[model samples]
Target: MAAQRMRDRWKTTLADSPYGVRTIEAIRPVLDQWVDRRHGLLTYRLVQLLSGHGSFGHYLHKVARRETSPSCHECGDADDTAQHTLEVCNRWNAQRHTLVATIGGDFSLPSVVANMLSGEESWEAVVFFCEEVISHKEAAERAREDTVDANPLRCRRRGRRRTQFAARLIP
Candidate 1:
C-alpha cells in the first residue's frame, strides 16, 4: 500500500508540475529502487533530495516554471529550463555540443541531471561544464554589447568627430 501510494504520488506530481516531472524523471532510476523493500533507506535519501523544497530542488522548479529566466546569455532568447539550457539554446549550441561530446553523447537533461544527482560524474566536472557554458554565453553577449558600444556614431558626442574619436580612444 505504501509503495502504491508512492507511485500514485509520483504520477500525480509529474502531471501537476513540469519541474516535478523533470526532477522525478531525472531521478527515476533511483526512485524505482525504492519499490524494492531492501533499498528503503537509500530510497528515503532520494525522497528527501527530491521533495526537500530546499534551494537545490527549488532552483529546478523555478527554471521550469520560467519564474527565473534562463535566457540564452548570447542571443538573449528565453530558455527557461534545464532541457532548454542543455539542448535547445541555439546561441550556445556549438559549445554545448562540444561539451556533451566530451561527456559522451545521448546527453539529454535527464541523463545529465541523473549523473549529477547520482555522483556518477565528479562535482568538479559538472560545475566546470555549467560554468564554461554560462561563461561562453555571457562572453558572447558582452562581445555583442561591446560592438554596439564601440561604434562611433552610437556614442553620440556633441564635439567634432575627430575630437570624439580621440577622446573615446583616450579611455
Candidate 2:
C-alpha cells in the first residue's frame, strides 16, 4: 500500500526505475544518519513531514498545487507554498535575506530545506529563519493595509517606520 502510494505520488513511470531506485537509495543514508543522531522534537517533526510520514508532504503538495491556501499569516497572501513563501515572495525577501546572511553563503530554497531536514544546520538558525520569515510577513501585511487605508497619518508613519525598522534589524 505504501509503495503504491509513493509510486502514485511521485508519478513513477517505469517499474523499479533507476531514478526511483536512486532517490530511495539516497534517502536511506540520510534516514540512517538521522536515526543515529536521535534528533529532538523539531528535527523529528521535520523528518516526518519531509518523508511524507505525516501530513507535511501532503500539506505542501496542497499548497503548491493550489488545492489549498494557508493564507500567509504574515502577508495575507491567499496562496502560500514552500517555494512562494520562502523564495519568490518579495514581501518576505528582507527577512529571508537576514536568515541567509546568518548562514553566510550562497543558498537556495532546496539547499536550505535539505539542510534543515538533514540537520546539517543548527536548530538556532532554523528557528531564527522561521521567526524572521513570519516577522517580515506581518510587516508586509501591515504595509499593505496602510496602503489601502489611504490615511495620511498611517501611510506616513508606516513608510518611515518600516524603512528605519528594516535598516536597523537587517543591517
Candidate 3:
C-alpha cells in the first residue's frame, strides 16, 4: 500500500541520516506504527528516560558536563544512564520489579516499546517508573545544587563579580 511504501521510505531516510542515531537505534526495531490512540502526551520525565538527555549522571556529567562525576548518586555505579536506571539500578528495583511484572521480564528498549503499545497498564507502568525515579533524581540534584550554592567560596565569587561590575560602572 501507499502508506506502507511511505513508511519504508521514511525509515530508509532516517536510517541514512547522521542525526538522531540514538533515538533511531532505540526505536528502529519496534517502531511499526507512527502513532497510537492509546498513548497520551509524553511527560518530561518520560522524555528524559526515553531520550537519554536528562538528570542521569551519564548525561549530566559526561554529555552535558554539568556534574563532576558520572557516577550514580543513588548507588555509586560507574555510569547512571537511562538503561541503568530502568533495567539495572538497585535504587529503583522495586519500581523496576513493578514494571517487569506488568510488561514481563525483558526490559530492553524494544520490549518496552512493544509492551507500551500493547496495553494501557503496561504503558502506565513505564510512565510511573520514569516519573518516580526521575523525580527523585531531580530532587536530589536540586538539593545538591542548594548545598553547592551555600558554599562560602561561591558566595565570595558572586561578591567579587558584583564588586568588579561596580568598579567598571564608576569609570
Whose TM-score is greatest here?
3
Give the residue spans of candidate 2 off by over 4 A: 1-29, 38-79, 104-110, 117-121, 134-171
Q: Which residue ranges in model 3 land beyond 4 Å of their true spot? A: 1-5, 149-171
Greater-TM-score candidate between 2 and 3: 3
Q: What is the C-alpha lDDT of each candidate?
A: 0.48, 0.47, 0.78
Can you write out model 1's per-residue Cα lDDT over 1-171, one digit (the tens) per residue?
897797878766766675556566655645553244331133322333334322121232353231234344434555434445556667557666665644555566466544554443432344555556545533543454357544442233356886868887855
Order of quality (TM-score): 3, 1, 2
Clashing pairs in 3: none
Residue runs of model 1 more than 4 Å from their true location after superposition = 1-19, 31-73, 76-79, 115-123, 135-171
The numbered model that scores best in lDDT is 3
For each candidate in turn, the TM-score is: 0.39, 0.38, 0.79
lDDT leaderboard ranking: 3, 1, 2
- TM-score comparison, 1 vs 3, better candidate: 3
Candidate 2 local lDDT, residue 126: 55
For model 3, state the Cα shift of residue 152 in Å.
Answer: 12
